[model samples]
Target: MEPTTTTPPEPRSRRGRRPHGKVRRRLAGALALGIGLLSVGALYSVVEPAPQTAVAQAADAATIAKGQDLYNNACITCHGANLQGVQDRGPSLVGVGDAAVYFQVSSGRMPLARQEAQAMRKPPTQTFDPHTQEGADNLAALGAFVQANGGGPQLPAATGEALRGDDPARGGELFRLNCASCHNFTGRGGALSSGKFAPSLDPANEDQIYAAMLTGPQNMPKFSDAQLSPQEKKDIIAYIKSVSDGNNDVGGSGLGGIGPTSEGVIAFVVGLAAIVGFAMWLGAKQ
Candidate 1:
């Protein structure tokens, strides 16, 4: 063969010598990185945190399991096996958290004596008789169960000074808007559609009020932190304390804090007395 040596293949350039597979992989990796960044940006835009969701850490798994068992046995009959509640017997317990359960059971307002207009608070009609330390343990267990199920607001380990806000006036405005219709501007509470009534805030302590707001105990609507900020809640509490602490213009009795009812009664009585006195004076003149 004429020189018999095929001309040496021209030396490939370093850039052009790169393997096709390696090039494809590098391009794929860059594309994946760009897609990930876009996805993160989209997620950041959509997700927002609620204000009052800063609850204490979750309860232990054992406590939750025990609570589930107790719920199944004692509460299932009325609250439903799944905690969805019975049609005519009990309202749904799905979102009602440990705070609600504690308030209802510990206060003896639950395990209702009868299905009535309202389940008023009363002495524990049914006592628990656990063989060992089960009574106290059971209560704790049940609380854990309701808590784990996930629904209502959770109580914090430390309510702290943060629970008390500085703006009572703002609280009053908020109260008028969100709570006045049912609770009355004075926190004296009012009747609802049926025999059920919003109980007076006078008897409710800070924790109790917070719990009620969080859990919506009975027929009340749930107020998640997303709906009302914690600072706002504190302000509401301050307003309640200010109004309930006996600083009103009522002649010392406070008259249950219902302005119209008390004022109407007073005006009616005074007006009637004045009319009678005028009549007597006219008669004397005659």
Candidate 2:
């Protein structure tokens, strides 16, 4: 007979392997594993999403996120998580308005180093250069967040020198009656009770002046919209800008325009002359 034992039934291991079933099992497992790997990658993609798309999809949402991040880093300690404010640290920001936020934050009155009688307008903790893309966006984001919260005053849509009042004279009158005590006639800031002092209006822009008047930051008393009409505020700003932009001292050199400067100069000159005269008299006597 032919080699009837032709196949010793292969080896037991090979015999145990059903080629068809084994290949099918392997293909199915590989397909499942590949799908699982792809799913994992997709999940990772979702967890770390694309920034541009997120921003485009919901600009306001993105703004809120950015504002929240900034708030947490710089404001949470003083202002509570909900903007309620910490006792003796910061007052609740709610209902303070975007005008207040813009005035305080843009001017760098916020993020104060330590609690004081009044918050001073030093160089801002965060600067926003309108020329830069990122800075403008960040500033807008912060303003938006505050606006979204309790509503109050708001910054005007337009900003420019043209916004000033037609008459600087009228503006001057308004300033003297309302602002001269705190800020000098030329808008030079002055000392107040305690550590608090009114800051110079030199650095302030028109919008900032308007906002400050509306909000009344620190120890400065609030000037409501009713108290000072918008036109009056604009007039005050015009006067400030006119004086700040150039010397308004119609008389001799402004010399700081503080009353004491000229007084001191007169005293020095007079005293020196008197001393010289006294010395000459003593010499004649000798």
Candidate 3:
């Protein structure tokens, strides 16, 4: 009875209980925040689109494998086991890229049958023909193989008429400035020093021309995108098509389409022959 009286009804507010309540509230708030974050993360995982990066990587790996197989079978002899090239047999294909491969293989200038001053264009083997599905696949595989070894120029996605540009006049100007010296004013092609010669544009298709520009093939100077933009390249293709397809030409005859030199020669020959014939007729009359 004396102890209870002295204790005197310990202060109505219990400090211990207050602190415990505050701690419980803080723990509840923290648990609620954690649950909210976890729920948001779970929702995002279900809604987000599955990434295709891994699938793309797998496909790329398969393509590279097929290319490597083709290279080992056909190209390894000249290009070396690692594309470093053989001593005098073939140049290194390391940095040449798919554009060069397409040009050389598709044009039949590669798989060289014989060693010569310059590789001549011939009919491509059935395996490399772009017209057939099998051939096209094989060609792509081979190009991919070379491309994987070292990166370089690539061919345009378009083909044939699609590659032609809308502005032929501007293309003509560019052709004259850069290509006229070797290909002639009409894209007729001319002789160069050594055994190398500028190939006639007469036989070149859109793909070949585009590949040549990208790769520079042999003696031709490489016109990178920096030098000639893709649009400019297309324009050049248009000009070549216009001239070579005979859609655009001067007055008459075109004099073999070799430009003024052939025209001048023909003019002189015809003029001299006419003069001589008239003189002979006059002599006969006398």
Which candidate leads in TM-score?
A: 3
By descending TM-score, how would the candidates be arranged?
A: 3, 2, 1
lDDT (tens digit, per residue) of candidate 1 on 213-244: 77776678878889888778889988888888
Models, CA RMSD each: 9.5, 18.3, 4.5
Q: Estimate every model's Cα lDDT from 0 to 1.
A: 0.75, 0.79, 0.88
How well does each candidate superpose onto the true structure, as a TM-score? 0.64, 0.69, 0.83
Candidate 1: residue 182 Cα off by (Å): 1.4
Model 2: per-residue lDDT, tens digit, 11-61? Answer: 567556689778999999999999999999999888876887777769878
Worst 10 residues of 2 by lDDT: 123-132
Error of 2 at 25 (Å): 74
Total backbone clashes of candidate 3, pairs 3 or more residues apart or in separate chains: 0
> Positional deviation of 8 in candidate 1, in angstroms?
29
Which residue runs of candidate 3 sit more than 4 Å off their true CA positions? 1-51, 260-265, 276-286
lDDT for 96 in candidate 3 is: 91
Q: Which stretches of candidate 2 lie over 4 Å from their true place?
A: 1-58, 126-131, 259-286
Give candidate 3's TM-score.
Answer: 0.83
